[model samples]
Target: MKIDELHQVFLNYPRVCTDTRKIKPGDLFFALKGDNFNGNEYADQALEKGAAYAIIDEEKHTGKQKILVENVLKTLQNLGTFHRRSSKAKVIGLTGSNGKTTTKELINSVLSKKYRTIATSGNLNNHIGVPLTLLSIKEDTEIAIVEMGANHQKEIEFLCSIAEPDFGYITNFGKAHLEGFGGVEGVIKGKSELYDFLIANEKGVFMNADDPIQKEKLKDYINKYGFSTSDTKYYQIRLVEANPFVVISVEDTIMGSQLIGEYNFTNCCAAVIMGKYFNVHLDKIKAGLEEYVPSNNRSQIIEKNGLKIVLDAYNANPTSMYAAIQNFTKIEGGTKVLFLGDMFELGESAHEEHQKIADLAKELDFDNVFLIGQNFYEVKSGFKKMKSFDDLKNHLTKYSLPNSTFLIKGSRGMALERILELI
Candidate 1:
């Protein structure tokens, strides 16, 4: 189909789905192909499930708007680019090995207080997700926070071509998706695609001055909202302690939030910088960060059965595990218990990454450590071996966990959160 014709459908109504499972009324479903299943096979099912149109490559599908395309995925990408160019919104693309989602949410939270904002929702920050996010933009969207994630060298470059961010932020480079990215250097190369793109496009870059590696990569971009690098174009953050909230000092103004940890403080700093550059008032920026709470299991504080649970177990990599450990150490607690689980998708570096986390746990001086998953086996063998996951569950049942703060962390594959249900 011609670009103009696709625009007539896409511009009028968004290209919304590929799966019939989640199709909503009036949504345009694209019959995309995958290894196991052909979306064309489900075209009729999508229409029956409330999709207004089913876009397919197969000629057999019949419906009101079941138009055929040579390739659905590429077609969606093209349509997304068209929609992105049609909008008046400024886009800020964010990508990194770790903390991309959290940072995207933080930036969106701060930016939304002053402008009509739309951000990448959930884990929708990949090739398919990026296009979906772009097409979701509406006329009122003054700003779009696009989160891009990649595990291969050229993935970020491909994503950037479609995203074409006006400004950008690379949260941090860490050990993640090592299978596809190769190693730390490959990780850097994959992530730096964003920086390279920003430089090529001549866009402003916001970076974490605290991270030496990230700072070095974007050395040419004028730094914004960081401390210690005051001469390097930065924003200062001084944490104020009080009851259940933290006071953040930006310049002369002190802003407060219920969030804890130096990592969150840094996350807030990035948001403040993004907001300031857009001319958002300091007070509004404060409200935005303060009102915004961390989502899912990342840095969430929960109270269950008289025990304070720090459930940072939504997903884990070496970088996030370290952050959670550091954050846990800073809090005043009864007895600190570490329920560390496996960090998955490290590929060849799995052993080394797992051991590094074990070393970190020992350095933190935890009262006890509950290691889970096969990856933790080597760590347990080297460090003080804990009883298995089965034994730990039994221990929790027989004995009351002391008023100690419990830290549950691991990659998504480990399902470490299951301990909560058993407890």
Candidate 2:
């Protein structure tokens, strides 16, 4: 069936579910396939669990209340594009290497102060997630914040085609997904695909004037608005301090944020600029920024036992890891400790990247540094290096660092957050 026909069915059953376990009454279940599992096989289960209709690509799964299509994923994406085209909500497409999810959340919080807003839930910023986010927009939604995450070339371009955003933002390109993106240059070109889309379609772009790369790349794009720390033609926000939490001054109005790290200053600024552009009251914008608390292990400060721990174990690449370390170093307090885990996705540069971080830790000379994961173990640093989390756990169980501030960070695979239990 065509996408329009599928959209008609979607109007009746507006709720869409890709997992049989999450199926609810009146949900339009789309069978998505992955390397490890085939969602088509669960079509019968989905219907039994109260799904109104099951969309399947496999002909063998055809049955009552089942719609067989050439490709279920493509149909779902097309339906999302159709819904977005019909939506009255002005969509804001956001992407970047680092801090995409946090920035997206901040933008949503700020925009929702004055408009009925719907944002991409959590880290749902990939191909499947982008379409699902678009499908979540309702008639009452005044603004839709869609976060698009891409690792390689053209992924953002494809998501942009589906989202068809009226405005766009790229957080900042960093050393992330290096394996998939080939290298830093590939990362720049891949992420700049968002800019290419916005420019080609004549959509507005929100940028960081402080970033030389961003400024240089968009030098020719006239429809760009930006925020910067120093004086610029666009918005200017000053960073007050980032001892533990970030405080910024916007138009002489000092706004305090729960977010940590100077790196997050730009994320907060993006929200403030977007809020002002949308005419949200300055006080409301401040309230929105102040109310947001970091969770899901992304720059969260936890107090356990006697130590203050900065848990940034959600994920890490070289760029973010270095920023976190630099921020931790500037905090004046008792002894500073670091639990650095191996950065992932560096590909052939993994050894060199790990060595760079190890060398920095040595240069800073934090009171104590524990490096975990295979990459770090091979760095040949004087700092304590553990082959795995189990090794770190054993060491932590035998020792304790009291009255010290700790920064724990690594890629998601390292599960560095688990160190909290040991501490």
- Top lDDT hit: 2
lDDT of each: 0.80, 0.91
Per-candidate TM vs. native? 0.92, 0.98
Residue 187 displacement (Å), model 1: 1.3
What's the true lDDT of residue 277 in model 1? 84
Residue pairs whose backbone atoms clash in candidate 1? 225-235, 226-235
* Residue lDDT tens for model 2, 1-423: 888898889988899999888888989999999999999999999999999999999988898999999998898899999999988999999999999999988998888889999999989889899999999988898999999998888899899988999999889989999999999999999998888898998989999998888899889989988998875787989999998799999989999999999999999999999998899999999999999988999999888888888999999999999999999988766889999998988999999999999989889889999999999999878888899999988898888688999999999999988988786
> Candidate 1 on 359-386: residue-level lDDT in tens?
8888777887878777787764444343
In model 1, where do residues sit more than 4 Å from their true spots?
62-64, 221-232, 239-246, 380-395
Report the Cα RMSD per candidate. Answer: 2.5, 1.0
What is the overall TM-score of model 1 with all chains considered together? 0.92
As for candidate 2, its clashing pairs are none
TM-score of 2: 0.98
